[model samples]
Target: MITALLVLVAFGSSAQSGYDLWLNYRPMEASVRATQFKAMMSHVYFAGSSPQLQAAREELTRAAKGMLKTAIVNTPADQAQLIIGNIDQIAKRGDILKLSKAERPTGDGFIIRSVTNKGRKAVVVTGGTDLGVLYGVFAFLRHVQTNKDLTNLQITEHPKMMHRILDHWDNPNRSVERGYAGFSIWNWHKLPGYTDPRYTDYARANASVGINGSVLNNVNANVIMLTPAYLAKAKALADVFRPYGIKVYLSIKFSSPIELGKLSTADPLDPQVRKWWKDKVDEIYSVIPDFGGFLVKANSEGQPGPQSYGRTHADGANMLGEALAPHHGIVMWRAFVYDNNVPDDRAKQAYSEFKPLDGKFNDNVIVQVKNGAIDFQPREPFHPLFGAMAKTPLMLEVQLTQEYLGFSTHLVYEAPLFKECLDADTYAKGKGATVAKVLEGTYQPGKLTGMAGVANIGTDLNWCGHPFAQANWYSFGRLAWDPGASAEAIADDWLRMTFTNDKRFIDPIKDHMMRSRENTVNYMTPLGLHHIMSADGHYGPGPWTDKMPRADWTAVYYHKADSLGIGFDRTATGSNAVAQYFPEVRDHFADLSTCPDIYLLWFHHLSWNYKMRSGKTLWDELVDHYYKGAAAVQGMQKVWNGMRPYVDATRYNEVKQLMAVQYDEAIRWRNSCVLYFQTFSKKPIGDQYSKPEHDLQYYRSLHYYNVPGLGTN
Candidate 1:
């Protein structure tokens, strides 16, 4: 069947392994105890006729039939036990909600409450707008799917940021950049027709957690995406997404005017350049009126931008912002820029380039900054720009794809990494000013707020390559909705929905997830060691690797390992990148005594014999962290092995095998890092742990072929 319409799959059918995602309409087995939540959804009624509202109805029906073993009949708002609709629909039905000051929704916020109808309990899923109401429907379904109590139900929620987007780095041909999952899901050749049912499933999964936008192409753009042909294909996907309230956006090559329009110059200051963009944007809106906007990655990693014309980043961003503004669209201009020729620290390049242009950006443009000043490392201090850009609205961009964390092969729960950054005190507006508060416009009111994740999805049957990787995608959306949300809380909800609700299963898995990120860090780059992944592939450890076209691109440049000691010194005597932060944050990282052990190596170059806070020498601490990381994976394996009784055979086996691969890779990471770093420290591999199975030369000689994600292109 063509993909344009919804396609339902039978549970346990060979046709689908994970095409259902978390929206599995599979009913509870007879062996499992059922929830006492049937009364909450006894008689459902929806009061709106829009496509979005209709989708809300269909979703509820599908979920109710599966989870409660019955279908819902449409009834009048007041008579039905459950009423679902937007404010306009509720008002049309004579204010069935009678929204109170506390219960009233603001913007895209939703309120799910228990209201009295003739002295009978009735649940109302409603919001101030149709989009919000649709979100409420999904929220209600999630509550049921997780087997939570519905009585005295009151959930008032709104996204903390306006644009919670997933940036898919999928290219035109289907190959993904740094994508550990299989090929890209967007079948470009077959699009604009034969829509896949998977498209709808993707939308449903996104809306279930309140993600409202997506960038459908790679940041390393091709001008062809801006053409009429591809826009038609994009429009097709946008149509499928609209019912779920997700607006489609594109990543445009900054020189599109030159390549697509055959212009001599794509300069922002040039009149011809401005008119070309205006005309192109007009053409796009004509095809898809609600086309979200453009995501630009220019003057970074060799992509052309206004910098090619001797113009600042603001020049490039403001020009595009002007074109999108009339259509109520916005431009997301990336701040991941640096000049290789600039004789400055690579870590400090983005701040030096963008910090000066803060107030100069147009109001409609958001400066998209990576979570770290450097590329997506396993763990790095929060980007200095989090608080530095008061005049500019900054969007926190993180990677959901495990590019550095071991791709899809190894399991790493990313919410802890995200929370660490969000909770960090930027001190931009003095104490208690966190990165989350800054993104919420607490530091600068009336500014645009957004959070973006580099997508990990692909054409794999399970969606994310590893089954557990799905939790990272789930966590990103939940946190994007509310930055202050507990990572553990999100994991609990996801565990119950995606796996089992059994406490025996939930308790151990949640603990495993909470510790997963730190575990990967320990085995890989413990104690604040950042960006030591292998060159080009970034697939394996390569701290000893210094040979690359660009000096800073290699692992050796960041770690600065030498005969004296290891780690880079960002203090006043060194690169002094710490100065970019507010005085308090700078001072906090500058002092070795005051600095946290987790970030010691990131900020200072300490001696191998230097004492750590744990009372272990730097050499011993490093070795211990690497071994601890590998051992933790074994612990995870033990936990999952015990979950077999609670999980199905297919899922149980999938996770079991992945955990085995993770264990092997963890050992490899430990061995390679421990062996290589030992050369500089000249210390013995402590007698307690196993010695390196192979020498450093053995690892360096191990050449891999056809690793995924790094496209042949």
Candidate 2:
């Protein structure tokens, strides 16, 4: 009997192992709110028989059983304490619900309100469509999970963007590009016949946050993904996600006609190539009727594209767009291209290539631009393409994987980084043209708007490798759903739902999460220093990395440190990259006196003894930021150590150990960068600062092998 009890305990613990994400639905403590929730949820009336409706019913039943510890009895709509369905299904009881026509939710939106029906108190969860009703159910559960009062609850929500997507860089072989977590969750060898239960859970987690689409494979395309055998595999995953409102998309090889169909040429303008693409898209739709569309990465990093045939980006994207248009599908064409042979600033390449072709793309094609001009640096000013491309629909793509920010070991909450980009003013129309507004199509109505996060998920027990890394995934969804949502509030809700609602744990931990991104920026790439990470895997500090086949790929190309000064010069006399933005924004960045300290180095190369706003030399200020950033990681360790009683032992210990690793790496970054850059500055290592543990050569000689997330091109 004792042995059986031990097995049961282990099973119970395993069941709660971060696998459920924010929907764990742990039993509520005895309280007035719990009693009220239990009473109200004792009987539920969920109507309709659609698959989405069934999914909602199952979710509500599961949540009730877990949180309230009671089985909900199916009751007639008139007698039930809780009524759930689409608004039209419950229109007969509209008198008590009192929903105004203006209050009615449009698109994938929902409304939840408390009402009285026939002298009985009831709460209604509903929307305009079945998918909306499903979203409403999750919102209602989140309300209860956060311990919010339900006495007079009234809530209305609608997604700000039309398409919220997770772009998984999982390869056909199960290796993920820049994935820090374990192997890809998709067991391709076993898929199309044996669907993992984890796939269903992934859909549920995404649905809970209003994420509606997913691209299944790496942007670095595989020809096999477009073949019949693999299309069937994608179809199986789509079936699991359909009920949750997630439509599956795939990344395609641009030259598939030549490789797969044995065609002589794969030029977009060629009649044979166009016919092949059209037939392939039709074949895909026959298998997965609701396949969202294709995401293409072309003419960048050796990926084949229209440029190979001397054709424009539009020619290639329009060819795919024309094929998918008949199926009501869209094509997401990435704007991350940069020619290595070009002598211009690498940051300016994407804008230069795509800006002129803004109105040239087909209606179904969206120019998917990265959040910043460069790769996902620790921090970057908003991409200039955001406000410039007025005629074409643009989708904001941000990375959730911690590639350059310490690869899942460091506890960095990325909500602030996301928010920083969203909140930046573009000065497109006037003063208040924020990137969020541009994404919402506020200035140009009736255009498609979307956000895509490069997923950090994998086969780890916690999904994200680091326990705290899960918060970045959660934040991405929330911000994608509503760009104006508060990062702090989202962090607070995640903490309460994922761990505990205790105030002691909530307040300090929330502050730590909010500060995490900035702390990482300070230690890794402080003051607009971008992309100086070690080559290939980008695992650690390598500010001195200069030798490479392409000059733009080296660290020395960006920082430009010399005996005179440091930083990339983008002013009129330099690359003139600042001219890409609107006049107001260009002026702010182009003028040395007006630029923000955070972005000082990005736009100007400055003297080592240049006096900063704080009356310190540029070298001194740089040193101070590095020291403080490393110290902040120690502070994070202290914060997590104090929360041991609140979080589960498995997660608590995991985080505690990861925190130790981050602190050590943080020190390494500080020492390596300071010592290397000190060579050019000829400055003293201040007495107040911590001395480097090893000489610069020792840090430079260190090489890491077998780093996770290194994908083959």
TM-scores of all predicted structures: 0.97, 0.98
Residues 1-713, candidate 1: write the lDDT tens digits: 11322323334442246556677666765432243345545667777778888888878777777666787777665678888877766656654567656667878888898788766778888887888998888888788767776777888898789999999999998999988889999999999986878889899899989999999999999888988999999999999999998999999998988888889999999999999999999999999999999899999889999999999999999999999999999999999988788888888989999989989998899999999988889999999999999899999999999999998988899999999999999988889999999998887788889999999999877789998899899999999999999999999988888777799999999999899999999999989898888774888788777888888888898888877889899999999999999999999999988999999999999899999888999999999999999999999999999998987777788889999999998988899888888888888999999998899898877655677898522
TM-score for predicted model 2 compared with the true structure: 0.98
Candidate 1 TM-score versus the reference? 0.97
Highest-scoring model, TM-score: 2
Worst 10 residues of 1 by lDDT: 1-10
Angstrom error of the Cα, residue 640, model 2: value is 1.3
Q: Which stretches of candidate 2 lie over 4 Å from their true place?
A: 1-16
lDDT of 1: 0.87
